[model samples]
Target: MRFLSSLLLAALIVEQVLGEYGMAHFSDWGNSKGKDYCIFFNSQWARLPQDLSKATRLQTYDLTSSVLCSPSDVPEGGFPNSIPMVMRGNCTFYEKVRLAQINGAKGLLIVSKDRLTPPSGNKSQYEEIGIPVALLSYKDMLDISKTFGEKRQVAMYAPNEPVVDYNMVLIFLMAVGTVALGGYWAGSRDIKKRYMKHKRDDGAEKQDEETVDVTPIMICVFVVMCCSMLVLLYFFYDQLVYMTIATFCLASAVSLYSCLWPFVRRIPFGKCRIPENNLPYCHKRPQVRMLILSAFCIGVSVTWGVFRNEDQWAWILQDALGIAFCLYMLKTIRLPTFKACTLLLVVLFVYDVFFVFITPLLTKSGESIMVEVAAGPSDSSTHEKLPMVLKVPRLNSSPLVLCDRPFSLLGFGDILVPGLLVAYCHRFDILMQTSQIYFLACTIGYGIGLLITFVALTLMQMGQPALLYLVPCTLLTSLAVALWRKELPLFWTGSGFVPPPIIMEQINCTQTPGPSTDEPPSNPEPATSETNNQREDPTPATQEEVPHLTDASNT
Candidate 1:
């Protein structure tokens, strides 16, 4: 199920990249207003034209440069030309566009250098070009050339209406639902198998000792990290995003190695001992291939994050990779119990609500804390940049690609908080020797919660604390299911809330002893029956008994 989810996530990433980079079609040409084809051109910093559709009728004209610079070119009219012009040349984009603008052209179209690749040039050079401009692929340029050669009149009109792609939305929803169902089923099956095995082994094996208490240390570390991250997010968002991309790339590469460690160990490496117990442990000198792959991923991430302008494919890849790493960590780290999960969710729920909603009210600006930070380098005057959030591009049928618009976003907290509960439920299922239905329920509930969040966001057209919906859905649904199965009492007393070993020992010491085979000696002994019973039953003791046990063993 995890594998399936990973694959689906990859597909979604690819779709986002393609949708953002892919070209919109010139569906038809007519005098009447209908669809105005959207085009992205000019400098990286340039904004889309707002009034392209306002023009009633547009005439097309083939363009040529008067100056010769490259082979297979002809010199033609230069300045004082009228009408929109299409030019095919190897000259720099700024030079050609400048010349066309001076010649009184209403619009400009540059023929691409190759059939598949779009024309490459510095879009930011000629910001003052007061005309609509577009780059045509080689094939498109040729088709337009043929149309002009046949003396056919070319006409263009602005789009009258925009449409929504319901099909795409439905597909995305279906994919998410499938992942939820599949994960639930798989977890349930595995839990049942484990439960049967545990039942067979129950009487023969001793229960494990209670785990150590690391709560204090964990809390301290979490608080420190959170404080540091918040500081960075507020002040150095862009730099932080770049660093995060690089870090996630490196981390994901390492995680990928860990996931494939089993297969990796099987590969023959002469005279080197593979550590079976400590998998994914690097040798004194790691394999060249591993180092190279890691370097490559890091390089790509850094390069993309730093250099790509207005090209959101890089953001999609980085965000998806980060998500994959987080999902992997969630699967790997087992949470201790249901109580722990509940406590975590409760704390995070409040944390999320405060950061998202209350922070604005507290601050003088009355702006959402997260939204202010997520506004990248372009939006902020500080010139800082960061990709701290994951965004999924929303697809619509409108010819105008709203790439610049805000996308569907999930904060890091939204994922990590609920994921901890899901992981805990998995561990709890194993500890109780029960079907994994609890984990499955929590996962599905999380998905449902996210769906609700999306619906609310759509209706309200505002930012929401995802945990507001997620926490209740996951906690209540899982709790209700546990209650229905008569597991609530067990959860409270047993695996869900096991007392410390010291307390357990103390309780045992105070209780009356049961019947034992060893009889009291026919001599003066300890006055208490508790001592006699303890001697007879010979049950294992807590850490407090370690010193006495050592002395007895030495003697």
Candidate 2:
């Protein structure tokens, strides 16, 4: 066990070191190096003729102007005498797009050094870019530049392409695969089974001796729910159409009725036990305390939501207290249960802090202040255009400058609250707490919170616009509450109140002794009058002696 723990520690250290290095070299999503600007074209000109109809005739001066001109000798304007353009060699298209935006460039053109393989279809086309973008061959560039001397202006067209980082996408895929493989390996190991065995009661039966008929029933339930959601969409088309459809798909794909899932285990297949007596067998102080701390973090997040920037100092104070608590916990983790808690703490701290700080430094430089001023009024008000706070890098250009970015406690609070809640639910099976009335109430609250956080965080990660993201989160939370109301009674009556029965039959049947060899003694006769007076009973007759058998062992 010690050796295994040491191995795991070593692996974690290695992983962390690699992760840090990866972050330093790549963007937040593990894309190519995120340098400031691409400045391939001037902001004054209409962006790279996305559509021929929208194209404005480029003026002689605007034809070769640049917003963020680097002192590079790269040819520009597709003309031999064209102006010098600053071209960023980011390894991913997404970074190129972002860099173009930061530099206030009118257009971006990405060229590959290797042979270009155009995407087969434009199903996932980019709807819009802050600036237009195009892909061209090196030879095409040369030919176009040679004509530039004659025409002095060339009509180049760019398509509406969704600029996604294929490399980042590949990394995401690999990480997911690695996690799945690790999970499978861990599941196949003996440790979990041994842990479950040790945790079982001394005498209990197997969990699933009888065949269950849950499949068809579950399928029917799913069908009914999906149909109901469809009806909701039909009736409340304007209000609920999108939400209803999303819910239906989620239920269909994620529910147990689905044919098979690679990552998710079958809900009813595992033999989790409900203790007959309220012994709190698996409950440990660290586990319970972790739950409490997670809940507190959520509460803080909620409080932050209610009072966005008003309680900044209070939030800071609370964080300090939390740090102190962590110090206390460091000492308390001498026991095994707290060891897992320690790991959880370390992970949460590192992941949150890393992203919070790194995002700013990795981002490209913003457009010039005068340029933003020169642009005409946008549909949004000035305040709307400005991020709640203006984040600027410190004069000291260390990685620590990321921390100097203007802080938004609310944003951090929202992310942390949900993530920690999810971890809490997973660690303790809080969803299974509906058995007792007190626990049921706790579950209802926690479940609602969990649903909200799940939807909110998922939407945040999915690139939804900031203003609209909260709606989905709120709606999901309300839906969860309604579902809990409907299921509470059933939960209380059936399996909810009864702890899952622990299986202990395996323990009793684990090992056997060698066959016995001692012979049976002669059986004594029934008690006589003297024996009765002596108050003693005769020896019970052996099974072989009593039964009409050739040879048999005694009972």
Candidate 3:
């Protein structure tokens, strides 16, 4: 599972980097006869294009001649170029679009000099152009122009919209494959271990067994925590934001201590040992450094999260911090058993589905519970509002400085719920003396599940309960693998199970011993010669019998 976790971490980092730039593609396209046509175009901005329904399938006009050349060089009655320094006969894309808008053309298609080269233009510069414009490959332009010469109207339309990227699909597949492999490897290893243990205790069935029964306690804790979070998110959002910052700080401090403690322990005189108890205490304590650094980071994150209104970098920093905290939890927390992890997932699955899907139906306003809460102001006074959510912003630099609304949002529940299962799987692997396959499997399942949830949200354009997909993928995949390996029986029985009758038989066998000449017997036995003589003479006990009879007569 470590491999899966590492892959997911890598994928996430890639996603973060790519998400910053946003993805672009044509949202809708059609031709002049009202039949939809596919045209390949690159996105210049992350924002959605303005309404283009009326402009669709409009006649295409080529103003490349006048718009491409220098403004001073263009002859009267030719296309007017807006940019002055553009080389003669070389198109300044922005100028061409401006000229097209000025000429009242419904659509403009520019032919690229090279068929393989994508058209480049500043999105902000062309925002006010109003008309639909597209840059076509030289070959496509030629084909269209040929059709136009035949008196058939040629039309082109291009509109950029915010949509999910293809990379997400790749991420999903990678996640699934990684998780399945991990589960299979882990399940195989666990089965081998159990088989070996069974062989070792072949005749001895009364082995001491320890069962872990923390399921109820875990469920209760989960329920309480979830309820508290929901309450805070819905009613006391501002306070929740503050709490989130403080929690991040505390988590950071602990993480710092953990990282530095090992090195601190290695230094001479760094740790002090008591003479009486021989208990070692750290002299070069990390607490002070942890406190100072944590405080500094907390102050910066909070100040940025609260005071820096609409600051993209501030939000990005918060997202980074949140991710770091989640990763730490994933690394530290341990789940007692695979069964417990499955139970937790199943419960959260129902919980997630209800809050995301059913709550909207129940509400009078007909809004998703998560969405409403996420978008709602943290405070009654909007001016003092703080965002409780962790968001990563999409930034655009070309043509203008614009920050697209945060494209990625991560909820605390999303991290903590699956994290518990992953942590549990990690501990299970360690307990079984196996590799980290189980943890990798669980982590991969989580990544794949999250990807599915994101895909659903993108396709449906609505909020989705993540655990609806996550729980089944993570729990069922690993469970099925275990079952296939025939490990389920032993695992379900809490590591090792022995029937009571078999246990009792083994106990009796161990307690009772076979005949041994070297040890004294409970009853005395005569020597071999005496035993033979008694067998030969049927009245061997005559002397003892006469004595007994004489004694009785005397009495």
Candidate 4:
């Protein structure tokens, strides 16, 4: 159940505990004068006589590079009372640690060029080794060497990694609250649009709330694009990450504008039209308020882009933009039915599993592709993180700083994916006049799924495919509710939400076909009167049929 190695590097030594992997503090000198590093060792791999997990007093060790491999590799002087810094890949952990132990080293420090994994050895081999051995990143090695010479004295101990961070509460609030609010807005807007359909003749208003109904064909294409983009990002991250950043800036600007325009448009003062001109987008002379709002949104997006790397405040901006973007996406893209929701969530469930659990087998680094991309490649030259995720800094102090990402991340996909279903449930509830039963059920399921994801994340210590839990929880909860309510059929196909036009569309096929010529029909008066009578009949539309009429409107 061991997770991928940590992303922590930079001034601290990293140590992995025995049964569960946790961080250990690495410092130079007995007085904590130099940079912070971690002394990462697994008691399971290289057993230590004294419990290093509870280590408090500064146990200083003079570092030496004499024994870089087996005992044969020990230097001529064979310095006593020194911890030999072993180079990885020269030999096995047991041989190297045994060599160091025989050479009078107190402990062994192994420097690696790749991600840190526990030094592995069998029980018999562990019994043969008397000194503790731990893995150190090449970066930490370089920092140690540059700061203190080859023969440097350093103190090492683990301060106990917290079981959970309070930041999880903040993360939960941000995630759940966003989902709830977004779903509420989506449902309320849908109901408002329903009420406004016959009341307003403004095409612009119709266009504003219009959403792209997801089809089975579109679901396949979208998943394919997602898979391709993820792989491309994994392979070309250092270069493509900037492209992602730019895309985020642009998209987030639009999202911000979409989310804010409704409020800003009501300001009334800036309602004057831009002077009519022949410019491409300005030909119709859009409102002055829209222009100002657009500028403000763009500026905010650009500001976030420039300062995204600033861990302190950048995360706040990123979270805000990310939430707005998710809400906008939920409103813009329509799932149409529970079937579409299931299709999307299930496909992504498989996609997430393949990348996180299975891809490691195919990868050279033995690291999950999803984790690698999410955490950023360990060998990335750019050191740029993708802006697609919502970030929050870790609250508790341990070895993490909080690692490469000072903040814990929850991708927008995790929020928006299940969120789409949640929103669908809300719309369904409104359509059925069911008092939000489906909406509440699905949202609670989503919250539970998220908790399970967090619990699994802690237990596995690996980057989990959140959809693995979220999809099933949300989809099943919705399904169960539909079954209980005896509305599964209607919910599945969303027939209960269909617009009035579709019901009459059946009349077209049922009606007789007339002459296919430009000449007017001799009985055109009867046809026109029949249409008027049919339209007049629907005006007394009872409350019972309102649900079907409001199900879906012809675009």
Candidate 5:
């Protein structure tokens, strides 16, 4: 599933027919007080005036003839000051509203069983009607009928939804902190890479060796996979959600182990290894503490999977694991140069925009494929959601909750795509001795980009392709820093600061023929390509020595 920014996740969950949300305050006219259930008011009709003093009286039309097409269906004197609830279908919304209005109904509540849409009407029809029109789901209608038999009063008023939810603050902190910390960690490790190499023994050495430096070719293939996987999930969500969950469980467990290994190694007590055995991969004497840590990480992921639906506390665990996963990826997947970083980030940028924006047109539901899959398919039988995103519950109570989207989401890709670049900057700074300037600039750029994304989210009210903003800001800021410091050439290629090769001097000496002290006379050593090596260490003669000096360039 795509990890996406879902500030207006309401687009998918809350289909605001008129781009407005209202709470259907249904109550007994006699009792005078009751619960308010959320409902949508159509923009085509008279908009609710937000004055609770004018509640429409609720009356159900005859069930058998629920379309209420005929004036005969109107009760004796008609619904004098009431709004009649009618079942959807069999007639146009305008026809239903007009018939209800002429029969003395104050408004119309069209109970719909399908997706919510506007009680649409032409401009001419708009002037011919005087009552409000709204949609109430069949489920809400049944609840109202069962809760209070009849004589119900309902008010439809749109409340101003708070554009800024407190959850945004939490999301900001989490996103910024995770990206910054990962960058700093990557840079620091790079600065001490040589020292670390000397200090690390068996397990740590293996861990260091496992990190894969990103390459230009690897990057293209990776983006293609991201696109393919996202599409597959969108199409086969039911079939793949299980595999996604299981993959996450396994992957997160390994990532968490990698993240924790540094700290675990310091424990000293767990450094002891088990005796050798022929039991498959572990036959090479594995560390006992490593095994224990592995089990704990696996346990956490499985626990999250089991209680994945527990909205109360499960999100905390998921976010914690997700952050570790991001950090682990930052460390393990090395970006070898600024060129590779640019290629990876830019390619993924296009990938995210295509999936999130362009796919809506291609989708039958008119919902973006990234958003549809990210939110979980509406028709899935399992109701299982992918746990790859960072989700935080909305901290305020608003009418928006009626949409069932109480959480704001940021996908792992959003964090990781930029994070990988930031990690490269840190390594760049440390290696080039630039005082972390590149790292800081890119990280700050990322934070600023995220801020812009949230702003777009608030104003536009839709899921945004985060990488669109993140890539430009990060890549440009880093490029600017390189230009300002006059290190663009070195930074772009990742050369200058790398340790010099010990054997290169010998090779150079052999290639360059200095003015001959003994005179290139005698036999001119004429044709001796082997004299290049003897020119340096003049005492070589033994077999091992013979191999060393003879064509040492090739050796």
Candidate 6:
């Protein structure tokens, strides 16, 4: 997952820069409605001129320097007092049309202000700017000039219609999502490998403790800076707000996942280490690939953050702390420390899919409700306001592309799985066969958390402060716990040693001594060299244990 993440980061950088630059420099379409090509003309038969009358017709042409060579070409510009040169200005067609109408002109005639190659197809450059405007092909303008001398009378009627483009938002969101998934998959793989090694070494074994030489603190600084810059961009960059937000959200999600997953078992911090005993040990090969991949993820995250802002140099310091914590969690997770990290990854994936796609779609669709109060006139002079109940959209269609409408794939059930996982983790060591009752409690508790997070984010997006929504979310977590009371004690007790199935079996059978007067062992031993030598030339069966889980998780 780590190597793949690096490849993905490289791809993300290339894809985004190329797409943005290419579209900006080469694509004819931009956010500028003032460009003649973006306009559309609508005229009736009565308004059509005698020579080239057409009704409800759509024609296209190129607008560039080559087509705007002379003033005589425009029928309206042919008047002796009138002159037509490319009129260059910065404003949308809507603004320009209003300006032209206010100046008492029948319509505005626009030609290319910049030199460029002609566009292809039946596309016409001339468009009716929203009020009786007329579009002209260069050829038409020239013909009008030759037949009627310098000027000809023309009229237009434009409307207040506006056009919207969501391409940028969609592109940015996709890029962010891809990068996030890459980071998570990569980071999780590394954690998984470490986990397997820890599991393998739990038995009788003695080995030298590996020295901690790497400076994870430095890497954390890099990642934190990246996250801080992304947050700033999302808040400050108005035009690219969607892109910035998407990037920030995805990066944060990945970072949290990377930092948390390894500790899914939640072993105490600063306690994990190689154990030593008389029994033989078998340590699987260290996952070099996962380590490299993790390093790459850290690098990409920091680099991206740095490039976004530099004065944020102070912000970079945050990554160092984050890196330290990530490394600690990474190391601890390798042992059968806690299931919390695993559960965290699962939770993050849940949040990612829903937050990025579902929630947005729901808000857009209006299936989610809001409350509004309005006063009606109170007397003969004023009516009384109606009772407020709920504010819902009349239709389910959302303007945003969040809910893959018509394809409606995910739903309330999807949210339940992760909740069940969390419940199961908390209920560790508990044995209950009552599926119906257990499932109902799980569903209700999970549903509440899901709903609370959804509402909190929605309110936050709509300008509600963190405190306002956070208070409610705290209650929601508390509720999930309260409703699922049957599982708590077992969860706490089960933490003694929740190893992998194989390791748990070995511990159960061997009757190992309890850690110093009832305390659990600080760390399990890694495989001894003697075991490695015995297994060195063993059949592929032994080799199978080497790379399966880590390799698969990374991919």
Q: In candidate 2, what residue range of length 10 has the lowest lDDT sum?
A: 15-24
> Which whole-number lDDT from 0 to 100 does residue 478 have in model 3?
64
lDDT of each: 0.48, 0.28, 0.45, 0.69, 0.71, 0.30
Q: Is candidate 2 or candidate 5 better by TM-score?
A: 5
Across 222-292, the per-residue lDDT of candidate 3 in tens digits comes to 55556456545556655554554444545544433443443443455523222333333323233333344
Candidate 6: tens digits of C-alpha lDDT, residues 330-396 = 2222212113323332333433333333433444222111110011111112111111001111122
Candidate 5 residue lDDT tens string, 416-523: 778878988887776666778898899899999998888888787667888888899999999999999998887787654533446445654655456765555355
Candidate 6 lDDT: 0.30
- What lDDT score goes with residue 167 in model 3? 38
lDDT for model 5 = 0.71
Q: How far in Å is the alpha carbon of 97 misplaced in model 4? A: 7.6
Model 2 scores a TM of 0.26
Say which prediction, candidate 2 or candidate 3, comes out ahead on lDDT: 3
Q: How do the residues 214-271 of candidate 1 rate in per-residue lDDT, one tens digit apiece? A: 1434544554455456545655765565555455455555444443443443555532
RMSD, one per candidate, in order = 12.5, 23.1, 19.3, 8.7, 8.2, 20.0
**Clashing pairs counted in every model:** 11, 7, 5, 16, 1, 54
lDDT string for model 2 (489-534, tens) is: 3222221212332422232222222236265323323323434433
TM-score-superior candidate, 1 or 6: 1
Q: Write the per-residue lDDT of candidate 4 for residues 429-489, one digit (tens) a residue.
A: 8777789999999999999999998888778765778888989999999999999988899
lDDT minimum window of 10 residues, candidate 1: 11-20
The positional error of residue 251 in candidate 4, measured at the CA in angstroms, is: 0.6
Residue 391 miss distance in model 2 (angstroms) = 32
The residue ranges of model 2 lying beyond 4 angstroms of the native Cα positions read: 1-50, 57-143, 146-149, 155-158, 162-178, 190-515, 519-555
Of the two candidates 3 and 4, the one with more favorable lDDT, higher being better, is 4
